[model samples]
Target: MGVHTTNGIQGVSVSDDARNASARRGKKGLLIGSGVGVVALAAAAYVGACYHYKDAIPEGTTVAGKSIGGMTSEQATRQVLTLKHPNASTKANVTAGDQSFDLAPASAWKPDAEKTLDGVTEFSLSPGRLLDQINGGGEKIEPVYSVDKTALTTLVKKAAESKIDGAPKQGRVKFIGGKVSIVDGAPGHGVDEKKVADAIASGWPKKTDYTTELVEKNSDASDNAVQAFAEGDAKKAMSAPLEVSANGQSVTLTPAQVSDVISSTTGSDGKPAIKVDTEALLTTVLSRGDKMRVPAVDAKVVWKDGQPSVVEGRSGKEIDESKVAKIVGDALVGDHKATLAMKEQKPAVMAKDVNVEALPSTSMAHFESPFPTGPSQQARIHNITTAINRLNGIVVQPGEQFSLLRALGYEFTKESGYVEAGTLQGGLHLDGMGGGVSQVSTTMYNTAFFAGVQLDEHTAHAVYISRYPMGREATIWNPGIDNKWTNDTGKPILIKAHVESNKVVMDFYGTKKYDVATRTSGKYNIQSPKHRTVKNVKGCENTVGGGVPGFDVDVYRELKSGSTTVRTEKIHTKYKPDDIITCQN
Candidate 1:
């Protein structure tokens, strides 16, 4: 009980029960306030820990068994480059079997930093993670590395292929000495390049090299299988030359000649089956060198009595593709001779062709190469004539691209009518198949340069040939190297090739679009030829300077309309130095 004062302060009185209730309330309030303070302290600790470790891998995180936690991605990448050692990558020489692993590094193995970071523990306040961070973090991330697997596989495969001493061959048809021979193979030990590549990839960016060994190889094709195939297919289809008759004329196709168009695969019945490339076979028979029937000749512009004249094109016969396959297949089982059905084909340029005399009457650009004086150069002239014939009177539409290889159908082999001739290879003028065709290519390149057409692609010869222009010439090889151009003019372009007694001429005739002015820079970076010893190549009589010094030059082409410059392009040629070869044995 409390006594109340009317005017001033009153003295409070407490009973035993009231005093107990007040004490209880005071104790409860103090306990609740203390609990709130503890919770505030815990929240501050969690925030501080999370903030301290943001943008960083958790502590005690390791890569390749080395600690890398608390480090940024850049810092972690640097550590991975070292791969736990300073000189580890310096001595990374690898070998397989007896062959050395000598290949241009496609690319070095790099640490997959992003992938590694994916495994890292990010900032988190979970109980387990918080406990882990308190006890110096325990997330272990495996080292991830990336490399070009294809390049590694190719390198290893090349090295392993050299271990072919006493190696078993896959059984297949072999054309030896113009005869079809069935080769046999057996199951044996061989180096597996893919397996070795995988093994190396697993431990890439490491220091050690592997001395790989041969593994048991499965038999690709059994000897019995190939022999059975030979009796079933090769014996009837490839044993003798195929006689293809059309237009009352017959031509012989040797086994070696036809081998390129034939393919072999396992049949559905588990027997070896042979497939004839019908389209390719048709093409082989239609090319000028091997055509059994006359093809339609397009109307062309020609010089007659020192004046332009239009030669009327005539209809010619083409082998009927619809019936040729069945006829050829049926003949293959018998005497290997079949008479192809022929049909009339119209010329691309019709009789009412465009008159050259009425349109552009003169050649816009022209180039020629003089014939060399030698009997060995006959093959070169023949190849030049063949290529020229294929490119003559060709019309390139506006915005069309022309590939010289495609026009000539570049196979450059005997079956394609190109024989062995002198061509530059490895700084030596050895007799190479389809050699003299480069002369035609050089002639065309010069003509196209002056024609002001866009040069899509062109490659210079490794060795300089004195006959062609010093820096404005081009050479082509199988598949990869080629001469290509685009007709920039908004008009049709005509290409004409003429073979003279003393020289080969190439002319480009069209609406005179632009006056292309060319200026060539002087040769720079001149290098003298090196003296070399020749062993494998034969028939070199010179012991002195067999080749000319190599140098680099740039040819500039400026297209103009009267006085204003339209566009400019530069063709840079770098010729390699040749060797003064001395054949000793």
Candidate 2:
């Protein structure tokens, strides 16, 4: 492994073989040294190149067209364009670099502060991908000869200009008639479309943030100065209280008290006179960000069924009805005018003792029938009254759900001795607590239909009943079938029901502006015969009925203006009679 060559004259004038070996050794050493020297030169050259470009254009200087101080024009320009650029644009904004630059013209040394470079403009590029390409020897100084900043800015501005502002803002507020309302917040005056196009070209207001804030008129400096110039007394609008009446008692407000109520209301312009919705104001005031609170006046509670009503200090009392009607009429004085909304409300907590005994005292007492006697008969009568009482004073908000079980807790049952009555497959039959309840449900359904509420889920009885108005009856099975509906009339609905003697009647009271009536027509579609066999049990008889064809019945309710049918709905009930079979003992 060792081949040693002595320096200079180590082996002079040797044998021919020794001379050849010496020449070979000298050649090998020369080749090794030449290769080593070449490698050293390459390392030194790499280090120098890195040093020359290290701070080429300085760290902060935008490199798109800036010059590097340490190198010649060609070298600096190459270095400037060699580094990678970052991506500032997003997918939704389109992938592009966000940082913009102004490049001096090829002949100019510095950029003009006020003018765009005639021949050059900066563009966005992906930082990660572009950097890889730059290191891999991609194009240096990408050309801007064909790029159009004006056109590109215009395109992006259209996509970015007040995108959220244009959309309606949603907020919850207390509305008139003692209800919580969700409505669109005031929309921003639309963007100056022409100005937007202009701003994009000029780059005005480079950064923007959009948000919502509760604006207080008195607290805002801008509002204070504007209020100073207003003509009417500011105190008058801010402090006025509205007048109200309930159950024969009337409350009148002094001018000073009225002003106090006014100040509590919200609106950039100032507080409004007349009726104000306190529920709406409370919700708005409690919301985060910007909000204000105003002291509310006293309110009265109007109750039904002798139930002690709940009076909310939170929600302001309703205004005088006569004044309300007059104001409404005045608002509609012209061909078309905004409605003067009312803030009317019934008692939230109805009077207690709303049982059957309490039914004889209220205004609904006039509709009660004589009480029943027999156990089964009395159960039926109690069922009807109990069902109706659940409806009494129950306020169904506009678009709210009305659940039958929710209305009737657990006061009914069959095991509790409300006998299993009715025919096996022909007449009205009872099973448990829900038995004989259909009559009451049907009555409610008819009343709702006539009142024009939205029926959610309704099912027809297995067999029709004579007491009900044809196919207008709603049948239900507890824990299985239930009748559901909603008040979609843009107003709340109040339900009241009572039973006296042999007659059970249900009534629905609501704001009336339309005349509605219902009638049932058409026969049940009797399809194939359905048979049913009843098992014999204690106090029960086994009976079998032959199958009968199914039938379709229609209940029609026509909303009217005098005699004209304004809106008509068809209540379709499909009846499938049970199968008939011979019974054997």
Candidate 3:
């Protein structure tokens, strides 16, 4: 068809194949463009979803058994607080070989949110991440936990050592059927710390119980070497009793004592060694030994501004219990006797050893004696005060006697801060050295009596003084007489005496063992006083106070521990009548 000539006749005719081909091309183009648009929209939606969950904790992520998946920083932090913290009682039981140990890690499974969330993100351009974000989460995060590294490491190492690093039993000295014998040693395996640690880490914070195997360790000292030393040491240690002295005190270690604590063990140098239990050794020595102990000063309560506060006291030279192992150990292996060097004397009463809270208060056992009045009043007060000052701060050790004479160190005379006061001699009133000290002696005796101590040496006065308790009073002379007592309480006794408001106050501070109660029988065998004339004897005071009937009496002491009486003892006293005296010129 010619377009120009057919224009007047309404165009030329086209081919049907061309028209159909043109329509097909248009339809194909539209379909192709629509497919491209759908793909582009899907990509945009994927990118937006990825950005939505940016840096979020992966869904299904759990920390220390807590679900914190898909949580934001703030939400995760708040959820971390709700995680059930590991309790102190939570323990991990582990077994290695035949020995089992418990691991009580202090909050070892504690969740660490900051560490878990640090640089964590589930959003990513990668296909896998995109798919994961769309489906919630793809990663299950391993919980980050914190622990006491030092403590956990030490515990792990200890478990390892105890499980496998056991040395061959060197042998133990034991008494068998009344004869000394050695308990044979046994072989043990060595340890592998790295192995044990690796095994423990595999299940920590997740596993509560574990089992491991130990490898063998090489020992320089064979089991035979240890047993050999043990045999020889046992023979020597059990031969005889060892009289050991430390800080002026003596304790005899019998074969039984030696056999109880002495044992052979493998040394770090791979040599066989003898080890002694210092605590058991000292306890035996102190309990079974003779009376050679001195008072150990301990902490006590003091009144400051009328308020009670614990005041710590200094310790004296005493047997060093820590070093006693070596001292007695050497003697067990070498000599049969030992006089410990002075350096071995340590403070028996350590700061930690003092029990000020349980101090035997004066309220528990208190004694107060009034000052004797008259011409000798001032002089007697002086004598009593002097005696009390000397008595103060003197501690009576268990198994040792507290002798006033020894504690005074010298006879109380006019030159030794004492004066002539009213004293009873030959049933007459006279001035003598250390006269009023009898009041002090009585006060101290009462303290010991009510405080539940052993009354070793005490004598009643000649006359029955109304002021002092009848039959309970004691009299102390210058050089001969002394009030003595022993601390049978198994604890140190501290004497704190002072003259307060005309009264001699004596208090014994120690650990309270039991409550003491006394019952005195009525006076019997009464003796009438005599009438006597003092023919101007020098220093004889004209019968200041006299004329009292004397008699025999008995006192019963009941020691009770929480309403149960442990033991009771009776004390008897015989007093001579006080004679009525008339002065003559």
Candidate 4:
């Protein structure tokens, strides 16, 4: 029994040992598996971090719609760009640093004013493209490239060699006749390659061409039959013989070996060559003797319509109709003849009809005339006629100024025969011809005062005299000083003057459009006039009592609707004491 119990104990021990060994092996295997799993997880995490932190961008990396990864600069910039979402809310923030600018992205994006923004450079981004990048959507983006000195130099040289420098200049290629011509390197019109390329790059079209003139030279012929023959045309060649210098030497034409003269010909479009009909051309040249006279063109000047016209003058005389017809026919067929001949003739000249605008009849109180027609009846008539003719159809526009110098250009020339006389303070005077013409000027002033024209420039005489209404007369001198006025009334006015045997009258004509009426006020503050003397070939004499008393005169014009003075001007003329000069010869 004791032996049996020991064996049982040993067996129990063996079983426990086996079970512990198995547990130890299982535990070792589980620990190895756990260690392996932890290492694998760590390795995977490391690989993921490496991928996330990589410095080199891989292929197919992109922003907006453009490819940006591992691409050469040229390949990266292969897309056309346009401003996207023109109406999109966009705000540009331009940030400037010391040497560079950071033009921030637009809030959205839009095109700026084309004119203002043309040729401007800026660095910028588009927010719409950024949003698109975040959404994995296709994008539109403006691109930028570096433009340093080296790159610009290379680009310019390449462009010049290609399209600008060697390219045909605009309009320089002139195709006339049949040949292509170009005035090479004409400065102002020459080609500039850089400008052209920039225009093309900026979406502007290149200029094409310009128009220019072409000229050819031709002259009368030469001699030395051989020399003339070398010039080609025989007829024009022998028209004038060439004059050689005093040294006797004949100019030689053919050196025996020269055969190209017969083939010379020229056309603008065709190739230039020397071609001539030597046989027939020589005959024409020899037939013409010295002194080629261009036949006289028969013509006559006659009254056609109202103007003089030149025609075939041989009409009423011994005119050969066939000969005249032949001349005209040849003229029409000439190589260099004007196309429209009839229009070149001067047509007729006619006077315009006198048109007087009808107006309400005005009547002035006719009284016993105090003014008298003085001596020199012929002179008075001539002055009155001249003044009348000048005043005929004279028109005054409202607000337009009238100058006496312009009107009296007639009185200053030698044709009027007026001589130079000394001026008195500001008075008009003449020594010889048309001496009394100032009578017309005085008449015009009186009429204008009543007609109500604005007085602009006027001068008073140094001395006063008779034959003129004391202070109411106007005096004018030639080439120097005169009276002037403006047509201030809103109406056209005409001055008509007429002189008969003993009377001179001036009448103003115009529609009562402005309702203007003028009147002279009281003549007051009269001063005793003075005397003047003149010395001629004989002696001096003082004329007495003829000098009129100086007086103050007031003239006014009433602008009215019915019976009212809308505007009034007071013209005060205080005639200085008269110095009546008496001439004694």
**Pick by lDDT: which candidate is best?**
1
- lDDT tens string, model 4, 263-311? 3222343233233333332223212311111112223223346444333
Question: lDDT (CA) for every model shown?
Answer: 0.69, 0.42, 0.65, 0.39
What TM-score against the true fold does each predicted structure earn? 0.43, 0.35, 0.40, 0.33
Error of 3 at 544 (Å): 5.6
Q: In terms of TM-score, how similar is model 3 to the real structure?
A: 0.40
Which is better, 2 or 3, measured by TM-score?
A: 3
Mind giving the per-residue lDDT tens digits that candidate 2 earns over 142-166?
A: 3222223445444443443234233
lDDT of 1 by residue, 516-582 (tens): 9989899999998888877766645344555688999888999898998977878788998876877
Best-fitting candidate, scored by TM-score? 1
Question: Model 4 Cα RMSD, Å?
Answer: 38.0
lDDT score, candidate 2: 0.42
Per-residue CA lDDT of model 3 for 1-585, tens digit only, reads 335345467665557887788789989999998899999999998788778867565655555434455445555564554444545567767676777777665444566867866655545677666565446564545546665454465576555555444733334445533245555555556345455555555666466787766556554366566557656775677778888886566767667666676665556566666677766665566554433344334444455685545445453344555566677778877887766544322332344443445444544467888875665388888888898877765555443556766565345655567877778887777777777888888888899889876677887787688898877878876334678875555445667879897799988877656789889999999998788888968766555454878899988999887989978888888888877778887
Better of 1 and 2 by lDDT: 1
Stretches of model 1 off by over 4 angstroms after superposition: 1-359, 538-546
Where model 2 places Cα greater than 4 Å from the true spot, the runs are 1-376, 410-430, 527-550, 561-566, 578-585
Cα-based RMSD of the predictions, in order?
23.0, 35.3, 26.7, 38.0
